[model samples]
Target: MSRTTATIDPAELKAAGTARQTDSSAPNADRPRRRFNWGKVFAWAVMIALLIITVFPFYWMLRTSLTSNSALYANDMSLLPTDFDLGGFARVFGLQSPEEAIAQGGSGASIDFWRYLLNSVVVATAITVCQVFFSAMAAYAFSRLHWRGRDFVFSLFLLSLMVPLIYTLLPNFLLIRDLGLIDTLLGIMLPSLFMTPFAIFFLRQFFMNVPTEIEEAALIDGAGKIRIFFRLIIPMTVGPITTVAILTYMNAWNDYLWPLMVSYTDDSRVLTVALGNFTEQTPQTGPDWAGLMAATLVAALPMLLLFLFFARRIVNSIGFSGIK
Candidate 1:
């Protein structure tokens, strides 16, 4: 019945609107935030389980290495060694003489532990260095230098990757035998020293990713290809090179079949081969499980340390290559 219009304050209406908005939003602001995500929790659980699964064998090996033979052969399995015994390691290192080992009821066979360890180190290092250097050179030629039939030749290298390594073993063995490199560490390294298809392919991928402008600039300044490669390319791709080095080193160190085929004596035997021989026992006693585990732990230490140190670089290199 208010035929007469009433004036409302605009400020008052705005104030009421603001008050309603604040009141409505207050509960949402004060409410607790979600702190748990089931998906994330499930992922974390799976990751932890996988980590335990991967690491448990190494832990068990270490535990066995520290435990006494009697404890290892006991009816109940102990996750942790009850008594810390170094006798397994002692026997492995030949710190305990055969007589002492026999008296202590341990494996009495004498193994040249240090000699085999040295052999592994020398051969692995040699293979890594030679392979990396030669692979880089080949990669440079493939990626940077233009020549006839380049793609065709590279196709051959790529094709080699598809061939199983075991298939080449006989021919390689025959060649090594003809060369009188049988039972020689040099023979063990010869097959890998020149260049590997995988190594060349891996380095070539990285090399191609390198900025061509940098090489062009160097060339304009009268720098030779060799100089550019050694000075520029190498410094820029250390990550990939290190990754290749680590891979090559690991392959050489862990190689068993080839080394076993060529090496008969301890002089030429690598750690893996020596470790196999270490477990061999006469008809009287059984295999030395504890001592064998100790030697295995020792043998695996260098590779583990290498991975621990270079794992980040290796991952980064792989990621970088994928991006390119």
Candidate 2:
């Protein structure tokens, strides 16, 4: 029994020694095989930095809007609102500015904020509809359909784009006045925005990028130019078209200078002009920092939300489409 026990103890000791050796060797084996990757970590850091930079402005704006007027004026400007209040938003949503509208006519008479809202809606909608229709048709002509001097005409339009808006401002104003469209929504919207060259060009490039085989197949099936455009081309490029429409709607909605110049009457005003009206208020009457900022936020909120929602699709379209 002692002899058997001595043999068993040696075997156990040998096994334990082998196990220890295996265990110690395991980590050493992995050490040579393991690769330290900094590329992924660097890429992640870059993305996080970009995200912070991109979203910071919007976060600041939200915090500022929620902050009280006195708190906003604190010596230490902060990312956080010192005193959070919603009264600024409330004042902005108030339909009538008593100082401008009600006072101008008196208590019984009210200035029409609703009218300005309606005006913005009408002008933006009409311009969007017209611009889309016109731009699409023009793009189709330049892309799929052939006409005389098409390249030359397109180049001229491109050159026109380089001319600064300031250069044509006077001419456009004079033209609007001559047409007696001054103080009218039509006057404010017609001159430059009704049919934008940029929109046409953007749509045209996307249209060209479309599979020519599809268009050819439609043509062989006895489809006309208009039919091919509506059925095949339009469906394929819906992303870019959506981007264009949103841009057009935003431009018309936020138009400040032209609307202020052409439309004076409360009957035909838009939100931008109305917001500016808040800034012109004398502090002796009552400073409206809260109200003014609120109105600006309200005006910008829609566009910001729109871009946020559609950013993915817009980016996809631009990535897929090209200038050539």
Candidate 3:
């Protein structure tokens, strides 16, 4: 008989709902605030310091190149070029006359900058091409092919990596001399043109990771080893190949000692060797700091650009190419 239910106000219900939502939205009083992390701050500070230390030298080189040779001694410690001039670059490219160069405190000796640049390009390109190709072939053989005494042969090849590069210079020089290739670009190219132990090892690591099932399928299809390598394995491993080529090219481009020992004249003299001679050309005073820095900056620009362009690829490929 008593079925009466108490009536509730919609307005009260709405207000209660609003209050609950407001309470829920409020910040938590019991939550702890984050404290400043000195460790992270210290790490960032250290990294910035190292960045400045590493980059200041290049900035100084740019400053020296921009400053006039006559004023370099006066403003030796200036952060910015006090006597700003582009004549150092002019001197580098042989645009300044001997009298003009000397008046500007240069050595007045021509750099043969174009000739040396050409020689460097030729030698480096030749070495990168030949070395990468041969090394990739050798790596394919070692990693993919089954043959008697393969591991032993690879071990012997790896042992060569332990040999000091300087120890072989005399022998290589003698061999080039006997071949009558001294003072020639061919002589410079011949030594590193075939392959390097490190190159083989690097490529072998990548080659070993290629799935064997794909190769077995190619074999079933009557594809030969050469065809399979060219068509299948190579296409699958472009990243490592590119990394290797970039590294090999940079090494060949920057090589100084071998080029210095083999070539004496402008015929095969590389930029590095030319720069060394350039330092001695102005013996009366000191090295033509302005012009020398300008030339050096020019010489190093290529590798810098190369690394900048392919840096991401190299970094990303190395992790995947390593022992798996």
TM-score each candidate. Answer: 0.84, 0.72, 0.84
Please rank every candidate by lDDT, starting with the best. 3, 1, 2
Assess each prediction's global lDDT (C-alpha) against the native. 0.83, 0.72, 0.86
Q: Once superposed on the true structure, which residue ranges of model 3 sit more than 4 Å away at CA?
A: 1-36, 283-286, 316-324
lDDT of 1 by residue, 86-138 (tens): 88899888999888777555767777899999999999999999999999999
Give the C-alpha lDDT of model 2. 0.72
Go through the candidates in order and give the C-alpha RMSD of each one to the true structure: 12.4, 13.2, 12.2
Top candidate when judged by lDDT against the true structure: 3
Question: In model 1, which regions exceed 4 Å deviation?
Answer: 1-43, 317-324
Cα miss at 110, model 2 (Å)?
7.1
Better of 1 and 2 by lDDT: 1
**Per-residue C-alpha lDDT of model 3 across residues 1-324, encoded as one tens digit per residue:** 354223334465456446555655777522221112233345557977999999988888899999998788774677889789999899989999999988888888777899999999999999999999999999999999999999899999989988999999999999999999999999998989999998898889889999999999999999999998899989999988989999899999999999999998999999989988864577477667888889889999999999899989877866754643
lDDT of 2 at 53: 97
Best by TM-score: 3
Clash pairs, model 1 backbone: none
